[model samples]
Target: MISLKSPRNSAQSNVSPPVKLLGSALIALTVFMLLAPLVAVIPLSFSSEKWFTYPMPGFSLRWYESLFASDQWRGAIANSFIVGTAVTIIATPLGTMAALAISRPETKGRNLLLLLFLSPMVVPVVVTALGFYLFFARFGLANSYTGLIIAHTVIAAPFVVITMLAAFSRFDFRLMRAAASLGASKMTAFRIVMMPLILPSLMASAILAFITSFDEVVIAIFIAGPDQRTIPRQMFTGMREEISPTIIAASVVVIAVVFALMATAELLRRRAAAGLKG
Candidate 1:
């Protein structure tokens, strides 16, 4: 019997520990740089001081209380949830359908279609917002909830399409064929076989779409009316005009919500992977 090691494996084994340590250090530093702002703002949200400051005299929930108590903040929260939910509902089905179409071998102009769907992500957000503003204004959709939802869906659908496309790339088409051979209708096969396999990815995509809508500011600013003010828009207003600790509290709340959504998405991803393996 003869044993052989690949040249790549041998090369990797020869790499020094110091090189790995340097890489690890660099990654840690990058993560710290990204999280630094959140770490600073989170504590400031609990500061007893009325204004933004560090090493507070004492910790207090007064700002959080103020955030909930204020009508503006409450309305913004409501609007954000409304728009985020609406965007998720609208974007998910459209994105999933687009992903399915593009993944099909028989589909024509798949690349072009994908490029169109993902163009929102490539173009500058301000540019996309300006375009939506101008387009919606002509239709009397400016300053309307419908306008805000449509604008958000344009951006968020791409995330769904991309996420599902990745999942679809790994999907086994044989199961759908098996279902079809078993006399299942096209819709029936998709509902029973395809959907179960893709449900986790769908859920993760929906969460991401909702988060995208919730966090979006530029389009919301251009399209949302005073009545449709979202949390991010409200926070922007606070930063420019009020400069209160309540904004910090709102930031903390937003951060918490984002982390929770991300955690859910991660869990769904793991479940999807496990199902595929099973």
Candidate 2:
């Protein structure tokens, strides 16, 4: 039989058993801590009892049924998708442009501009939400779908900017010159030579933008009208007005969907990175 162990693996195997056990235990503990609340809520969502309780009397899909069949829940979900998609569409291109501008060697104050672009992620949500409320109210934009979409775009754009910045950092800009020398126009070069190389990162950034918009409730609370309530806003209202297990069911579903999106985004990011290495 061939020896399969690499030097790195053999060195790792030389670590003390106690150290490995301790490391494994810590990781398990951390995972448990992070997942405990979500796991607890999931079971309650499935409880047959109308009220939240431990050791549920039975199992039922009543909450899940309410989530899908009810008009309010269904409307809120539709609104969330609409706003999230709009935010993604607006943020992705704008963010990619911003990243391109900042990545140029001739661009001055790149660090300062990058900081301003990413300020949304560092600022308090309430402060940002309040600012949106005040600014949009002046134009009668608050509580409208347009206002919600704009507010979400502001929040979501930062993630795209961050993702695209990293992508641009790994990108080779000389390809533009190469294409231009081959009788290609700037737009043609970007469309044919540059965009394909950066496409995976673009997709990953778009996914992140959508997820950011979908999960945001603070901006929605301040800017969204009664007719523009998204899932997060609806879930918040449910928690405040009625602690229905339906909210829990909605949350579980949202979590699952977000996790899937995040997983796909990570996969795309890795593929982009692999392409760069290759």
Candidate 3:
């Protein structure tokens, strides 16, 4: 009684249950708020309703049927795939060459050259599109598949260049010298000593170029017409005439495909890093 007890150790006291409940409720509310719109679309895509109303009344697969039946959609998908594949095929090697040239040990003004190569990625897509439109219009390239592929390649190549540049930067020059001293031909040295080291980055860069070309829209719009419309272009046009849940379904598919590609790229990168470590 004379000596007062030490102050209560409130610091050791358990957090109030109500406070914990409130925190969890807030977190749940935040997650729902972020995902609600996306979740809402899945049901609406299946909704029997003809309009874009939320909290669908019932469900049907009519939109999926309509999507498959549309010749325009099929044409657009084909066009996008063709353009994307062509862009990847052309861009990857060119980008790798450009990166190698720019990264050469004695290259003067390498930064400026690198910046020039990367300009497409830095510049606004709309500006690039407009410039290409005018340039191609002069050359009668507008609305042609060739022009569309070229335009997309311009944008996609930078991604490949940047990725491969990173790989090139990590290269050890001693390996090249060692191979040469061992009497290997220059081409053989590159193929045997350098190619395997950089192959992962090359693959990753090609995948990125493909994705960039696949999703490109601004340049496509400027160059593509009825004959060359891409999937994104089709989606853009579809918004003008009618709204349907099929768009959501298509978007979900695109997202899934992109997610898979990104996952693969990550795996490749990790493998490359591990190889380097070894």
Best model per lDDT: 1
* True-vs-predicted CA distance for residue 242, candidate 1, Å: 1.2
Ranking by TM-score: 1, 2, 3
Give each model a TM-score. 0.94, 0.91, 0.84
* Model 2: lowest-lDDT 10 consecutive positions: 269-278
- Report the C-alpha lDDT of model 1 over 56-165, residue by residue, as the tens digit: 88988999999999999999999999999999999999999999999999899999999999999999999999999999999999999999999999999999999899
Candidate 1: worst 10 consecutive residues by lDDT? 46-55
Order the numbered candidates by lDDT, best leading.
1, 2, 3
**Where is model 1 more than 4 Å wrong at Cα?**
1-16
lDDT of 3 by residue, 145-180 (tens): 999999999999999999888888888868999999
Query: Which residue segments of model 3 deviate by more than 4 Å?
Result: 1-37, 40-43
Scanning candidate 3 in windows of ten residues, the lowest lDDT window is 4-13
Clashing residue pairs in candidate 3 (N, C-alpha, C atoms within 3 angstroms): none
Highest TM-score, which number?
Answer: 1
Clashes of each: 0, 1, 0
